[model samples]
Target: MSSNPASTPPPPNRTSGDRDATQPQETAEREINPERDHRCESRRGGTVIIEGGTVVTVDDSGTEFGEGHVVVEGDRIVAVGPGSAPAQQGPVRRIDASGCLVTPGLINTHHHLYQWATRGYAADATLFGWLTELYPVWAGIDEEITHAAASAGLARMALSGCTTAADHHYVFPRGGGDVFGAVVAAAERIGVRLHAVRGSMDRGRSHGGLPPDSVVEDLDAALAGTQEAIDRFHDPNPGAQVRVAVGPCSPFSVSTDLMRQAAELARRNGVRLHTHLAETTDEEEQCRAEYGRTPVEYADDLGWLGPDVWLAHTIHLSEEGIARLGETGTGAAHCPTSNGRLGAGIAPVRPLLDAGAPVGLGVDGVASNEAGGLGEEMHQALLTARARYGPEALSVRDALRLATRGGARCLGRDDELGSLEHGKLADIAVWRLGGIDHTGIADPVAALVLGRLPKLERLLRGGSVVVDDGRLMPVSEAELTHELDRASARIRTREVSA
Candidate 1:
């Protein structure tokens, strides 16, 4: 990567009184006029000028502006520079981001939105044990339950500053009534971009798999459902609100035939492939016992290693597996918090980045990682990497990049959604760092990644405000909470009756 002209070295720490001296002239000039600003009003197809903030682009050159501005025209970023935006001709919505950090909206590379209703169960269980305990409960989910759970999950993600999320929904119970479509509907309702991976599991205990037979699909049914999802929701166009991917759940729960066929199906439709791989030693042992090879080698044999593929967890990869993934341009979703919760070993994030593999952070699932917020993943990833490797294994900027650019690479949306650059979608996040939690932090990026996750001031998705001033704009939190409670109770009731 080349050097960025706007980039600046980390500033010296200062008292709250001295912080104002660091502001640029343009930033100091702008003041909030509630009547004129209309801070969080809808911005569809309009010009939005956000100035007076620390701008971290996370672009190829690692651009950082001490105090800068971003101009959004309609759904795309029109300009980004070191000072206030140039004058605009028509009526414009001006945001006085005087004490905020502006950057590209965070992307979540992996999640299980449907698991939101299943949190707090199997809290002390290992990966396999947790799956065993939850499979029966998940077998009762219908389209209504899935919609409620996914809506609550996505609302939490938006509150945490994520603009785009990739949800891997694999559990399809009998007579679920379009459970996959419910996930898509929840994304639309929440107003965030969705990479809905139509995941399938075909192997059951009868076939030596982890999940029960009731939760598994037949081979033909799984393929047909995946194809239907793609035909209904996959959008190849840029700035798409929803896209579909093919995912056969995991090596332990999905048959060999399903895995190979799913990969072929994804490639045929020009969509991406995702799955769980090398997440635990148990999974590695199971793969070796069944296929006489490591997880990565088995995937390689099935043509699952490529740029269009990203595997989740990836905590137990061998050095050779890591090298192969890098050489093949495969992506990895590093879920640091979830790994630590399940006692899974730390993922080789630094090694993966060094070997040219794209690595992004993930909040694996609320079931294991109860918090399920994407912002804190950066902090967890940094500490875990340094604790396992060395202090220099990851940096604050590197962690931020993992959430933004690296995630885009994993989801194959690097061209449109990652960085704050011209011609890119206006999916931006403004975090308020002037509060007590982040007031004294000198470097804004460090304040964001190293300190507690700052309160989100505003989150724009495709130039529309989804979260404003730490509140969700599209739906009520109380409503989602109520619906989630009902969904959890319904699933639990079905389990009890069975």
Candidate 2:
């Protein structure tokens, strides 16, 4: 595979290791302004100019600009270069990015947003054990609670600098309302780009699946619902806020027939496919015992390996499996924190990248990870790679790339969402590195990945600010917190009674 070119040149006559002296040194607070209606069609994403920062463009060319500017006209970035951007012909909202590290907004390749209310339930369990302990609790979720959970989780990711996220929600109880619709509403309310995967588990214990009978769906019903979701919500337009995908829960939790049908449906509708795969040794053993083939082989047999498909975890792959994934152009979503939390072995991220497979970062579900921030996942990915493959296996920029471009590739949206470049959507994040926590840091980019995550001062999706001054814009943080707390209490009350 070819390496990305150095798009932005370093300081003139400076050595490679020299600190970029032109980086801003102080952060000035901005006064609160009245909330603007970001959803206005007339706005069409109004013009914005972000100037005076070190821009890290995780583009095909690894661009880094010391003292640069980005000009956003409407929803797309029009220019990026050193010094001030050329003035637009009309009115523009100017953002003072002084003392900030500007980059494309982080992308999350996999998540179970509805699990937000069930965090910490299986704190000491492995992958299978954790799912077993929490499946019953999740079976009680209704539409209202699911919306609350989705809103809370999406808001957390937005505040942490994520602009686009793919959520895999597989648990569906009878009369539980439209779980997919709930998350879609939540994403819209928060103004973050969403890739909603219509996930299903059609095989219960009687059918040898991991989930109980209560939460599983019929195969035909699952396929129909998936197609309906695609027809109803999947948007193919560039810079769209909501798109849909098809996801079967996992090898252990769904049937081979369901997997094939989900893949077929996704292809039929021109959407992507996603699932959990090879996350644990137990899963590998289950695939071997049930199908007489490894998970990758089994998936290949079912026509499930390709560019349009991305699997979560992927911690237990063999060399052959890795090669097949790369050859087939399949994607992998590496959830470092959740794997560590469940005692799952580290994923072969370096090997996956080296093999040319599309690899990205995922926080997984809140129940397994207990946290949903991409910044935390970036830190964990760095530490885990070092522990398993030596200190130099993963660089700070590499981890950040996984969280940004790698994730966009996994979701098949790299064309517009991953990087801060001309003709790309204006999904950007401005993180303040001038705080005391970031003191003495020479390289702001390295500090963002290796040091404690500094404050995320501003976040924009399509040139509209979703988080400003570290506060969520569309919904009230206090209200979201209270709603999630109430939903959690409701679930606990039902669990205690059951």
Candidate 3:
């Protein structure tokens, strides 16, 4: 959209970071001026324009260096491409992104937001062992900790250049909290697009499953909660801000009956499905003994193989399993760092991608990864795939696509958030091309993937700034530390009994 520059506000690029940690909610919203919040404008006011950036629209035409900007008359991208993109010489706020590489905000396919508080505890544990150890810790969650953890995770992800994400929260301790719609509130406050999966586990140790019985849900309650979460937060509009997915934690933690029913319920409501599958060799053996088939075949038998399903960590898939994934349109959420740390095998990413299955990168959970940075997962996805095969087997661009479009598709949000194209949400991440890692690099996108992590200069959700100048512009560091410190002290004390 064109602007006269005189009436509109100049770039609010000033570093509001020290305010991020303490005023987490307000800062995350970037509501410095309440009367003029862009989101409010979308709901009640008018339009805003993002002008002049090197737009990297990851469309079928590949990357395009459209020198012009984008126009968001409301919440949608009204125009793109230099001269052809719409220009509204109207009253608007102009963000001049001259020397930045603008791509769709990174779509995090899978995440565990509350687990941010439980990272170091599960460092040396495997998939089953890891859950056995931290399941109790998660069992302690309350509304306070859940809110803190969700805000903290979203802030961290936003700072790391993620604009939209899917969080899979499965722990439901007796007195834990009302996970019901807390994730939705957090996303609204943070101003990022979110898909919060109502993750569940029904069979516990008493029933021969992995999790403690205390953390497992009654099968009926589990199914009811899944439907409730969808009814309350699963938006299906074009530019939806929130959605829900039905996730039955894993093969070992849930009963096969719950798995089959969860699939049926999700289909009934038209929501997507997610679950952890084939993450490690131990998992494979466990499933074989209990379910009588490999993870892929087992899920297929349960009607969980389709475009609506995305399984985490297909690290042990065989050749036939990979082909089945491709043919069925099922997706995989690859978590390289979590796999390596847990001693789980490297996922057969090369074979999966070659077969044309949808693949997206995930950070898994903070407890397993110990790091939640957005770009970090993309880098790991690239490295792990190449390590398993040759360089030609996977390129940096392939990994990047997994983080963006593939993630959107996995979360069933591909129509909106994945790419920087017209009629999509105005969520974009802009990184500089002049960092130490790219002082003399030639190609911009290559400078990002091959070189050191490009500095996250700015991150926008729906054309609103959340991170500016390598830090969260709204929250303060001191506040985040205080919340983290308080949480840490409690966690340390509880771990003794937990």
**Candidate 3 lDDT by residue in tens digits, 1-498:** 011122222122112221112211111222224335333332322455444446667665554553555666566677766522343454555444554566788987888987767768866777778888888777777666676667777877887788888889888878767854666777776678888889999988899887778889999999998988998888887777788899998888888889999999999999899999888888789878877899899999999899999988898998999999999888999888888888998998878877778888888788888778777887787787778787665665666677888887777777787787878887878776664666565455655667677767667777666766666655655676577667666766776786
lDDT (C-alpha, whole model) for all candidates? 0.88, 0.84, 0.74
Query: Candidate 2 local accuracy as lDDT?
Result: 0.84
Give TM-scores for every candidate, taking all chains together and pairing residue i with residue i.
Answer: 0.94, 0.93, 0.88
Clashing pairs in model 2?
none
lDDT winner between candidates 1 and 3: 1
Q: Between prediction 1 and prediction 3, which has the larger TM-score?
A: 1
Question: Which candidate ranks first by TM-score, i.e. highest?
Answer: 1
Residue-level lDDT tens digits of model 1 in 1-498? 122232457733322232233332232324443344343465487688887777888888786777788999899999998866777766677766767889899999999999998899998999999999999899999999999999999999999999999999999988888999999999999999999999999999899888889889999999999999999999999899999999999999998999999999999999999999999999889889999999999999999999999999888888999999999999999999999999988999988998889999899889999998999999999999999899888888888889999999999999998899999999999988866888778888889889999999889999998987788888889999999999999999998997
lDDT of 2 by residue, 1-498 (tens): 223422323322112233332323223212234364533322345567777678888877677777777888788999988765665655556666766788899999999999999988878998888888888888899899999999999999998889999999888888889888999999999889999999999889899877889999999999988988988998998878999999998888888899998898888788999998889999889899999998889999998899999999888999999999999889999999999999999999989998899999998898888878878888999999999999877887888899899998999988897888899999999887755677677677777888888788778889887887787878889999999999999989978886
Instruction: Find the 10 residues in a row with the least total lDDT in model 1.
Output: 13-22
Ranking by TM-score: 1, 2, 3
Clashes of 3: 12
Give the TM-score (vs. native) of candidate 3. Answer: 0.88
Residue 281 CA displacement from its true place in model 1, Å: 0.4
